[model samples]
Structure formats: structure tokens, C-alpha cells
Target: MRKALILSSVLLPAITAAGIAAAGSEEKPDVQTIVSKANLVAYYQGNDGKAKVNMVITDKSGNKRQREFIILRKDVKDGGDQNYFVYFHQPADVRRMTYMVNKHAQLDKDDDRWLYMPALDLVKRIAAGDKRTSFVGSDFLYEDVSGRSLEEDTHELTETTDQLYIVKNVPKKPDTVEFNYFTVAIDRKTFVPMKMEFFDKQDKLYRVIESKKVEKIQDFYTVVKSEVRDLKKESKTEMEFGNVQYNINLGDDLFTERYLRRPPREAIR
Candidate 1:
């Protein structure tokens, strides 16, 4: 979700410095601070970035489908508002389809999302209720493409181990989401969320998002591969990132509705 990989050009050094400063410190950061840092590390990387992603969707019967897309993201402010543009590039049927999001940080404001279906020649506004629905028939939800706001959940530091800080998050408005609650296991050193487990109303674990691989790019620790599994359905989506670059100075104009229909050259390339 949200690229599934964390690649930072501008913020890595700061994170490293903070990590060095906290070395051997017995007192751990509060739950809010830990969650905030994890959020920033996961979603708010460089000022702007780009990644080419290949998604493999597999059903319970073991049939598989693949989709290829390029994602472009620009941060309005670190740990605040952001913009996302995704252009599908493969599998003929979905080629040229695009999705855009104007993500607002305010708790009272909802993110604006749009989907462009080239075959139908329609640009449709995605309803807030649909954010949790399957994304392009994949296990990942639409909300996974951008991110869910930290303010929407109340967090508690449930456990701390030598390597991770475990936090349990409960939705502030339970009715708005499908999961009863979720717990995130964040790496202590990098603050990257290593795994997230989502439990259903019956308190049974039904979904899981986990980081599969991490790499250092441009001196930044980044997650390069991940998977989302629907345990109940025995289906899963595996995503791999390639050709990722950060701080590319992407312009705001590239994310506008105009480009959704006629994708910019940068997006297609």
C-alpha cells in the first residue's frame, strides 16, 4: 500500500540521525510519536518520487493475473497533504487507465480520488465508501494506494521487543472501516512498518500486509517488495517495485485531471 516501498531522498539523513541519537536509550517514544514516525517513513518519503510496479494477483484456485503501472507521488508537505498519480501500462485491457488522488491531511476532510477508464472514456470520481474496495480486482484496497490517515485511529503501544515496537490501532469510527482493529509491527531502527495484521469483527485475523524486502537506495532504506494476503479467501497480491527514483521535481500540473485522460509523457515513460 502507498507504493508498498519507502524510498526517501530528502528525509533519510534526518531519520538516520534520529536513530543514532536514540541508540541504547531505554525510554521508548510514546505511541503517537512512534506511529507518527512510522507513518512518515512509510508514506512521506522524498518531496517527490516515482516507481514502476508489477502486481501479481492470485486466486485461491492458483490462477494468476498481472498488472503493470507506474506511480508518481508528490508531497505538499512532509507528513501532511500529498498527491498521487498512477498510470496503467500493460495487459491491453487496462492500458492507459489512470487513478489520481488529492490526499488531504485534515481529519475532517476526505481525500478526493478519480479513476479514468479509457475504454469507457469516462473519468469517474471514486466515492469515499469505495476506498476499501478491491483495487482493479486486486487484493489491495484503493486506500492502500495512498494511505489511511493516522488521525482516524487511536493507537496504543502494546508491546516492545528488541527489534520492533508493536502498536495496536483501533478505528475512531468503527463503522467507516471493515476491520475491527489492526496492529502494526514497526522496526525499531528504521521505523518502517514491517507488518500489519487486520482482524475482523469476530476478532479473527483476516488480512495481512507485510514488507517482503528492503534495500538501501541512494543511501535511504526502502522497502522494495511487499504482499497483501486475504486469509479467508486464500488470495493474495504480490507487488514488486523497480526503476524507483526520488526527488525528481515532478510538477503539480502532472497530477491534474487533464493528464488523467491524456497522460503526460513522464508518466508513460
Candidate 2:
């Protein structure tokens, strides 16, 4: 009998069990290798983590709406399955709202998401479609919240600079994606995508996301501040993360539907 090799659903496109080779080393990696590493580095930090996020959504007319939430994330395995629980605290009307996600690394499967509204006292499952749709009326999309699967895009290493690796990514299914292609500039040292630009089929830049600041939190390099701009709409959203702590003990129970209606006080804090 032969044993089959189990592959990590996340990085199978490029990275292997050994890991990405260090930059400037003898073994330089390809675009897939760079993207695979960047995807993990950007999303999967410690086994589990928690953060308080403050978002300010500004419209073209200069109207601003504020939202505050506490995010709890747990990794079932690095570059594999993960779970997220978000509890909204600010903006009196939307207070006590909660969102939960069960993300699978499999590119073919859609992540499971659910939302809870305290005012209505209702929990509804979010249908997966057009992931480009605004999340909570913000410029950030649903895909941005869970993560964009590495396998959904084909990567090309266009250039390499002293501090960044520029890669162009084209979606596998053209009709399924809103943009014709997008480019990401990954920091060579930190493996974080410092900036990204999205272009429509006409090759017009429609959206941009940038990391404004990053700091080392508990030895892990983290993006503490970022912004997303909708060029067509002339709108922007600023996201700032605080009180970040990694490897927190977020139990599996927190990611369940039961918690959607009845959020765990401990997990939110």
C-alpha cells in the first residue's frame, strides 16, 4: 500500500512544506512562490489573534460614517482553514452586530459567512456571490475580509526592486471577477502586500489599497493602518487596527451560529 501525500490547500500553487527561500539568497523564487508566501504572511500570522478595528468611511460629498469592531481570528492550520468572529461596538444603531466566517483554503469552495443584527434580533447567512460587493457599505469587499485565494489568480513577477516584488495577477475566470487584472507590491523583507491597484477591463484604474503603516507586534510584523480608495466613486475608507494580540485562545465555539445571536463576551473583548 502506498500513502498519499496531503497537500496544504492554501499554498499548493507554489510553496511547499520547506517554505519560501529568503530573498537575495542563492535560491530566488518565482512569482507563485512570492505570492504564496505573501498570502500567508499577510493573513496567517500566529495560530490565533485579536484586534480592535476602527473604520471611517468617507463618501464623495465628504460625509463620514464610523464603525468600530473587535475581530477574533483562529487558524485551524497555517495556510489552511481559518475562522473569524467580528463584533461591532460603535455606531449606536449597528451596535451589538456580529459577523462570523469559516474560511476554507480550497479555491473552488465559497467561504461560509453569517451576520447578526441585534436591533432586528436576526441572523442571516450571507450568500456567496460577486465578492467584490462592498462590505458593510465600505470600500473593502467581502473577499478582502476572508482573503482572496491564491489559486484563483495567475501571478507574473513583473519586477523586483530593493524593497519590493511587483507582481501582476490575472483572475482565472474573467467573467467572475470585476477587474481584468490587479498588481500587488509585496515588501521583500516583510512579505506584506504594501500596495495594490485594481484595473477594469478597459485598463482604467478603478480602485487602490495601500498599507499606510506597519509595526512589529509581539515579534510579528503587522499592518496596523491601511486604506482603500474607490476611484470611480471618489470615496475612501480608512482602517486602523489596535490592541492586537496574537495566539489568543479563541475557542471553536466562538465561530458557531449559536454565537451569532448570542456573542461570547470573552471573545469580543
Best by TM-score: 2
Q: Over the stretch 69-167, how does candidate 1's per-residue lDDT look in tens digits?
A: 999999987777899998988778888899888988777777888999988989999876557889779999977767778778899999999999999
Model 2 worst lDDT run, 10 consecutive residues: 1-10
lDDT score for candidate 1 against the true structure:
0.85
lDDT to native, each model: 0.85, 0.84
Query: In model 1, what lDDT does residue 85 have?
Result: 91
Native-structure RMSD, model 1: 4.6
The numbered model that scores best in lDDT is 1
Assess candidate 2 and give its lDDT.
0.84
